[model samples]
Target: MDEQPGLSEQYRRVSAWPLFIALGLPIAEIGVLFGLVPIAIGGLLLFVGSIAGIVQESGYVERPWNLLAGLGGALVVLGAALALSQLPGFSPGAVLAALGSNGLVVRGVSIVVAGVIALGVGGAARFVEQEPI
Candidate 1:
């Protein structure tokens, strides 16, 4: 690439926004879960992150932001799992009786699956970014 100038650099900057935001994910989570900030901000971050991941060149494929997103998302799901284990609706033995009785098992399983998938995707993205262009 020979530096196309103007639009190219602009796009590059735009592309980097997600990487920047990924680094700031903790703040975004805090704003949404703890600070009680506007959902709009959180929603915007999620939307931009998704779009940036898809459209931008992301340098290669090993994008750190993508990896972080996947890992961080998985961690979020894991935390939920730990918290759910304590809830009266479910336990190691049974989910208020049986895993299927309350039907929470399905949802829990889905969340864990989603988390794993996210982690895989994020790791792949990071790999792409780190690879030789």
Candidate 2:
């Protein structure tokens, strides 16, 4: 007979991904900004890690705590992005001025995209059926 891992063990294993993403990404971004590594490499790491964390957490749709952890990770990533965008000569207002009215369109689209992602995270936690252990 095959022995399955206990619930606590399973949870511990599954929870680590979100926790790492939520905590690690910002540190990595700061390191990048401090010139510890090439900006391209650090940016790529941040982007991939964020996507992986979100996708991994989506698998835990039945677990509210896991979803909440994912949301926290996403927020951390968003904060990092905002910070990066403000660096040196990349201010949003300056870019928006260059783009004229099209900047408003871009901002509106981004808001809609963020809303959809938020809905997915919250809706999955509330609506998805948990599998029996």
Number of the top-ranking candidate, with TM-score as the measure: 1
Best model per lDDT:
1
lDDT of 1 by residue, 51-75 (tens): 4464445544534466446554754
TM-score, prediction 1: 0.36
lDDT of 2 at 89: 59
Q: Against the hidden true structure, what lDDT does model 2 obtain?
A: 0.46
Give lDDT tens digits, candidate 2, residues 1-133.
1466465665554444565555556655554454333342344344444555566566744344354445544644564455445444555676455334443333332323343454455556555756653
Q: What is the C-alpha lDDT of each candidate?
A: 0.49, 0.46
